[model samples]
Target chain A: MSGHMEITLNGQTKNIPGNASLQALAEQYTKEPTRVVAELDGAIITRDAWSRTILKAGSKVELVSFVGGG
Target chain B: MPPIAHQTAQDSFELGGKIFSSRFLLGTGKFRNKGELKASILSSNARIVTVALRRIDLERHDENILEYIPDGVTLLTNTSGARTADEAIRIARLARASGQGDWIKVEVINDSKYLLPDNEETIKATKALTAEGFIVLPYISPDLYVARRLVEAGATAIMPLGSFIGSNMGLRTREFIQVLINEIRVPMIVDAGIGAPSHACEAMEIGAAAVLVNTAVAIADNPPMMAKAFAQAVEAGRAAYLSGLPAKRPQGEASSPLTGFLFE
Candidate 1:
C-alpha cells in the first residue's frame, strides 16, 4: 500500500505507483507524450514540467489531445 | 535618382493579424480516413484548419490527427463540447497549452436538438479569451446585435451560422448573414449548414470573407474532389463579388440594343 495510490484520471479512478510524475502517467497511456496536454486538477501542466510534477493520492488528471472536429 | 513607388498589398482573408489567401476554413472532422483528410486539406489549400480537443482514443494509438495536418497551417481549435462560457474558456486554455497557436473558435451551445450556438455565451467567451491575447472567433446565430457585441468584445472574426451545424441546410439565414457582412467590421467567416459547393459559393457571392465547412466534404463519395469543388466555388464566388455582380432588376433588360438587331 505504501508504494501505490489511487488517483482520478480522465474521470476514471485508477491505481498508479506512488510518487509517479505526470510524465510517467502520460507514458503509460501514450508513447508520444509530447503531443498531449495534461490538466492537473484545473491547472495546465506543460510537457516540459510534466517530468517534475509528482502526483499525490486523489490527484485528478486529464490528458487531452487534438482530434478531428468542426 | 528615380522616385520609387510603393505598392500596397491586400489580403482577402486576413484574420488575427495573419493573411491567408484561401477563403476556405476547413474542419478536420468526420473524415473516413486520415489520408483522405490530408488530401482534402491539400486540395482545398485551407491555411486555417479547425480541430477539436478530446481525450485521446486509447485504441487508435497508431493514428493522431495532428500528424495528418501539414506544417505552416494554422490550427483553429474549436470548443465543441462546451455548453457555457466557462467551459469554452477552459477548452481554449487547454488548446493553447498544446503549443499550437491561440486561435480558438468559441462555440458555446446548450441546445442539443439543433446544435445552435448560444449567442450570449459565445460573446462572453470571446471577450474573456481575447483579453488573454487569444485570437478568438465566436460562432453564433447571424444576429446583427450579437455580432456587434462580439466585435466589441475583441473577436477577430464573427462566424455566423449559415444554417444549423452539420445540417447542410444551405444558408437558411442568408439574409441575416448578409446583414452581418454588410454591417460588421470584422471578417464574417460563415460557418455551418453549408452542404454543397454551390452553397459555399452562394455565401461568398454575398460578400462573406470566408466559410468553414465539414459535413459536405467529409460525407461526400469522394472527399478530396468534393473539397476541391468547394474551394473552387468559394474562389468563384469571391471573384463574382469583387467583379460586382449585376444589380438585380425587377424587369428583364435585353443585352443587345433594340436598334442593332438585324431581324427587327
Candidate 2:
C-alpha cells in the first residue's frame, strides 16, 4: 500500500509522503529549519511539533520566513 | 503683501473629499499603551491617524486597540507588511472588508533594514489602489521625481519621508522635500523621521501641507505632553506661514533709516 499526501508550501502545492511529519519535511527541504514558521490550516505550529505532527491526505499549510531584505 | 508671506499662510489639505483640520497626522504605534495613544491623539489635535491591519486576538475581546480610539478620529489603515504591489492591493481590500477605513497608506517596503519604499511597487500599488476607488497615500522617500510620479498616478497625497523610517533624523532631506513641495500639485505630507515638534514646524514652514509623526510622539517621556507640544508647533508654524515671515537679510538693517539723505 502506498500513502500520499498533498501539501502547499509558500503558495506552491506538491505531493509528499503521507506519513512524514511537517518537521521532517521542513528539515529535508529547508536549509534553516529554525527560521521558518508554518501554519496548518491557519493555525500556527510550534517548532518542536513540526516533525511529530502527522499530515493527512490534503492539508493546507503556509510557511512564513523572516527575510533579511525589506 | 509679499508673495512668500501670502504663500506661507495656507493651511489644510483636501483629501478623499474631506478637509483635514490639522496639518499633523499621527500614527497609532510605539505608544506605551492604548490609553496614552488616545490621549496623545487628542492632544495632537490630529484628525487623521494611521493604523496597521493585523490579526486580532479573538479570545481577548477587550485587548483590541481599535476600541480605544476615540470617536471622530479617522483611522487610516496602512499596508506596512506588504512587500509587493499586489500584496498591498490585497491588504487594502482586506482593510476595507474589516471596516478599518477607505483611506490606505500604501507602504511597499522590499527591504527590511531601511524600510524604504520600493518605488516601482509603490507606483504600481498607487495606480491600482486609486483605480479601485481607494484613497491612496503612499509613504515614499524624499525623491522629488518619485513624488511627482506618485502624484501623477492618482495618489490622493504624496507622503515623503523626512529621513529613514524610525531614524528620527528630522528633515534630513529638507532641500529635496522643498523641491517636491514646489513641484507637486498634490498635498505634500512629510512622514517619518520627525523627532520633535520643531521638526514638524520646520516641515510646515517649508510648505509641507502636513507632517506625520509616530516614533517621536510615541516614545517620548510624556506622550500627551509631546502631543501638545507638537500641536502648538504645528499651529505656530502655520501661523508664521500665514502671517508672513520677514524677508531674510544678510545683515540687520535699522528700521529708523540710518541714511536720511533723500528726506534732507
Candidate 3:
C-alpha cells in the first residue's frame, strides 16, 4: 500500500510518497546532493537523517543550496 | 608586566539603550563550515554577529546556525536582498518578529555586481525603521555626505564600506572615511572590504569607532588565527588612538638648540 502526502518544496507544493526521505526526494530533483540541505517546518534538517525521515501532509519543505559567486 | 590598558577603554558600546561588549561585529555568511565559523567567531571576540533570513526548509531536520553561535553574542539580522525602501521595511519587520534583536543592518544592494547600497532607498528605509522603533545601521558607501544624510534620517550608526562587499580591497575610500571620522558624531564602523589586520588598524587609526569584518577571517586558511589577529589589531589601533599620537612636524628639530651652546 502506498500513502500520499502533500508537501511544499521551496515554494511549490506537490504530492509525494508519505514515507519518502528528504534525500530520496532530493534525488528525484537533482543528482548532486552535497550542496543542498533540507528544511522541514522552519527548521534545518541534519544530513544524517535526510534519507530516513518521513513526510507528513501540509509540511513545508525547503531545499536550500549553497551558491558561491561573491 | 602586561601593557597598561587605556583607562577610558570600553569593550562594549551602547546603541538604542542596549550594550554590546565586542567592538568587532561579524557576518555569518562565507564560512567553509559550521565548526570553522564557530572557531573564527570565538577568536574574533565579536559581541554581535549578523545573519540573513530566508525561507526555512521543512523537509528534514534542519541545522540552526543560531544554535552554534555562543549565547553571549547578539544576533543582528540583515535585509541583504532588499532593493527598495518598501522591501527593506518589510524585511526589517519580519526579522524583528523572528529574531531576538530590534537591530537591523539595512543593506539594500540594488546593483548586484558592485553590491553597493542605493543611497536614496537606504535613507528612506532608515527613517522608516527608526520610526518603527528599530536600531538601524545602514550599510552605505564611504561618502561623508551620504553618511550625514543617514544620520539625519535617524540611523543609530553609519556602516561605511571600505570597498565593495566581499571584494577584500582594504580602505579604498580612506579619504572619505577620514572625513566621516572627523564629522560624524555617531559611531563610525568600517564594514566590508577589510581584508587584513593592517586594514583594520588603518581604519581605527583614522578614528573609526569600530569595524565589522567577515570574509577576510572566514575565508582564510586558518580562520581562528585570522580572528585572533583582528582582535589584536583592533586593540592596538584603539590603544594608539587613545594614547594620543604625537603631532606631525614639518622638519626635524634639534633636542638642544644648535646656537645656544656656541654663544656661551
Candidate 4:
C-alpha cells in the first residue's frame, strides 16, 4: 500500500504512489496537462495547486480540455 | 433617429465591458479542417468565436482545436455538453483555467431531440459563473420570463435560440425572440438553428444585437464565401433596421395616384 496506490483517472484505473502529485498524474496522462482542468473527487483543483495536491488512494479524478464546439 | 447611410466605427456593441464593432459571433465547429475554420472566421470578420470543452484525446494530440484559432480573436468557450447547472459551471471554470479569458457561453441542454437549451439550468449557471467574475452569455429558448431571469442572474448577454440547435431551420421562434428583444435591455444574440444568410439577416433586421451562425457557414460548399455572405447580410439587415422600415399599408397603395393613373 505504501509503494503503490490505485486511483481512478477519467474513469480509468491507474496505479501510482499514494503521495503522487496531481501534476505528475496529469503529465503522465496528457501532453498538454497545463491546458487541462483537473477535478479531484467532486471538487476542482486549480492548476496552481497541482504540484501540491496529492492523490490519495481510491481518488476519482477527471481531466478535461477545450475542443471545437458551437 | 433615421438610419445613417454609413455606420461609422463608433457604432459598436459592448459586451462584458468589451467593445466590438462587428455584430457577428462565429462558432468554430463542424469545419472540414483547421484551415477551413481559420479561413471562414477571417472571412466572416467575426471578432468573437465560440468553442467547447471536452476531454483531451491523448492519442490525437495533433487534432487539438485551439492551435487552429488565430491570435487577436476572442474565444467564447461554450458549455455545449452540460445537461445541468453544476456541469456547465465546471466547464466554465475549466475554460477560464485554460487562460482563454473569462468569456463563457452557458448552454445547458438536457433534451436531445429538439436540442433546446434548458433555461432553468442556464440561469443557475449564469448566476454562478458571473458571480465568479466570468462574463456569462446564456443561450436560452427565447422566452421573455427566462430572458429576464438570466439578466437578473447577471448574464452579460442573452443568446436566444432561433430554433433547434444545428437544425438549420431558420427562425422558428421569431415572434418570441422579438418579444425578448423588445423587453430585454442587454444584447440579444440570435444563436442556433440559423440555416442561411437570409435567416441571419432577418434576425438582425428585427433588432438582434448579433447573430451566431455555425452549420450554415461551416457546412457550406464554400465556407469562406458563405461566411462573407453572412457578414454582408448581417450588416445589411442591421442597416435596414436602423434606417427604420417603411410602414405597412393594409390596402393597395399605388406609386402613382389612382385618379391620375390611366385617365390622364
Candidate 5:
C-alpha cells in the first residue's frame, strides 16, 4: 500500500508514505541532499542508492550531517 | 626577500599523503555564528580543521557548516558521539559516504562526565578504518603502549589529550604527552584541553608536532583575533623548538665579569 507508514527517523517516529525511498525522506529533511547521509535499518544508504532503497514500516532511519566540531 | 633564520627547510607536514604547513589544527565547533567561524578559519590560516557529525535536526533547520568552511582546507571529520569502535567506524563510513573526505578523527568516549577517550576502542577503530584505506587520527589518553599500538594500527597521527577536552586547563598531561612525542613515530598532535594561545605555544615548545584547539577559540569574545593569536603562537613555538631550546642549568653563568664595574 502507498499509504502512510511509521518509521523511526533520527529516533522519533515519523509517518511517511509507505512507498517513500530513503532519498525522499532525506531530501524532505535537509536542503543539501548531497551532504546528507541516510541509513536504512543499520546499513548506510550511499547517495547513489538512496533513491532505490525503499522504506518499510518500523524501519529505523538515521540521517546525519557534518557540523562544526573539535 | 630575506630568509628567516632557524626555519626548518622542507618541514612540510605530510599526513595521509597530503601536505599542510600549519601545526595549529583548529576545531570548528561552539562558534557564536557561522560568520565568526569563517573569519576565525581565515585568520587562523589553519590548513587542517576538525568537524563532527550529528543527526540532522528534524524539527528545526540549521545552517550548513560546509558553506562556512572555505575551500582547500582539509576536513577532519570526528566521530564524537561514538561509544565503541564499531560505532566510530559507522560514523566514519557515513561521513565518507556524504562526500566528506577520508580523514577521520577516531574519538570513542564512553564516559559522560569526564568525556575521556577510550584508547582501546580508538585503536580498534583505527586499525579497521586504516585497513579500509582511511587516514585515521586516533585520540587517546597519552599512554605510551596505546600510542605505539595506534601507530601500528596505521594511524596517521595520535592526538593525546593535553588535558580534558574543553577544560581550558592547558597541558596537565605534559609529561605523558612528552613521552609520546619522543617515542611515537607518527606525528604527536596534542589534542584537547588547550585553552589559550600560550597553551598552544607551550605544547609546541615541548616538541609536539601539532595541536587541536576548539572551545578556547570558539568561546573567545573575538574569535577571529584569538585564532590569529593561536596561529602566531604555534609558529613561535615551532620556531623555538626548531632553534634548539637551551638546556636547563642549576648554576647561573654571569654574562659580564663581576669586577668590570667602575668600583673595580
Candidate 6:
C-alpha cells in the first residue's frame, strides 16, 4: 500500500503510488483533467466519483474526452 | 391581425425539450483546424453541434475541442466509435459525464465498406440511453420500420442518412426519406451524405426537422461561406415548405394571359 504500482492508463502502462485515485491518474495523464471522463473496466467513473475510485493493479483505464466528430 | 401562417405556434422544432428555430445542425469534424470549425459554426448560426469522443493522449493531450464551440451552442456528443449497443451506451455515459449536456447522437456502424449505421444496434442504444435520461438521436438509413422502432425506443429524434457518409451524393435516398417524412411523428433529421446547400434545402423543403452537415462544409474552399450558404438554403427551403409548393403538372401551364398579352 506504500509502494509504486502500475495500471493501464489510456492503453499505456503507468506506474503510480498504490491506491491512487482515478483523479490522480487523470491529473498525471491529461492536460485538462476536469474535461475528461475516466472509465475503469469499461464503466464510466463520473467526475464527482473520480476522487473515490481507486485504480488497482492491472486495472484497465480509458480516459476519453470530446473531440471533433461527425 | 397576424396571418394564419404567421400566427404564434410551434414554429420551431422541439428535441429533448429544447426549441430550435434554425433547421441546420453542424458537425464539428473534418475541419482544417479548430479556428475554422468555430468560424463555420458561427457563420451557420447553428444552435447545436455534434462532436465525437476520443481517447485523450496521455503523453501530450491537445487543447480541448470544446473550447472552440461558441456560447449558447448545445453540444451533441456522438458515439461514432461504437459498433454495438453496449459500446454506444458506454460512450454515451462517458459523454454525459464530461459535463457536456446529455444529448447523444447514437452512431453504431459496423459496416466498413460504406460506413452505414446499424439500425438494430442503434435502436438498442436508444432505448438504453433514453432510459438513463440522455437525449438520444439515432442515425440510420432511411427506413420507415426502423424510424418507428427508434421512436418507440424513446429516441429524441431520428437521423436518417441521405446517402453514404461524406459521399457528396445529395439525397440519393429521396423517396425513402419522403416515406419517413410522411409516416414518422418525431422530428426527422437528415444527417449524412448531404453534398451541397441545395441538398439541405431539399431536405427542409420536404418538411425535415433539420439537416446535419459536415464534410460538405468542412472540405469546401471556404468553410465559413459554405456554412452561411447552408443556413440561407435551410431558411429558403423551410419557407418554401411552409408556403406550400404548387402541385406538379406533366405539361407546361401558361401563367401569363395565354392570348391577350400585348407583347404576344
Model 2 clash pairs are: A23-A50, A23-A51, A69-B112, A70-B110, A70-B111, A70-B112, B8-B241, B9-B241, B9-B242
lDDT of 4 by residue, A1-70 (tens): 5789999887888889779999998898788777788889978888899999999899999888877788
lDDT of 6: 0.89
Alpha carbon deviation, residue A31, candidate 3 (Å): 23
Top-down TM-score ranking: 5, 1, 6, 4, 3, 2
Clashes of each: 0, 9, 14, 0, 0, 0
Looking at model 4 chain A, report the run of 10 residues with the lowest lDDT sum.
A28-37
Superposed model 4: Cα runs more than 4 Å off: B1-5, B256-263
User: Which pairs clash (backbone N, Cα, C closer than 3 Å) in model 6?
Assistant: none
What TM-score does prediction 1 earn?
Answer: 0.95
Candidate 2 error regions (>4 Å):
A1-70, B1-12, B57-62, B255-264
Residue B235 CA displacement from its true place in model 1, Å: 0.4
Output the better candidate (2/4) by DockQ. Answer: 4
Best model per DockQ: 5
User: Could you tell me which residue pairs clash in candidate 4?
Assistant: none
Candidate 4 local distance difference test against the native: 0.88
Model 6: per-residue lDDT, tens digit, B22-125? 77999988998899999998888988999999999766878789999998899999999898999999888888887888999999999888999999999999
Q: Evaluated with TM-score, which candidate comes out highest?
A: 5
Ranking by DockQ: 5, 1, 6, 4, 3, 2
lDDT of 3 by residue, B106-169 (tens): 9888898888889889989999999898999998887778888888989989998899888889
User: By DockQ, is 1 or 3 better?
Assistant: 1
DockQ each = 0.85, 0.04, 0.09, 0.67, 0.88, 0.84
lDDT, residue A24, model 3: 84
lDDT of 5 by residue, B1-264 (tens): 887754655667788898887888999999999899999999999989999999999988778999998999999999999999999999999989988789999999999888999999999999999999999999999999999898889999999999999899999999999998888789899999999899999999999988899999999999999999998999999889888899889999987987869976
**Evaluation by DockQ, superior candidate among 3 and 4:** 4
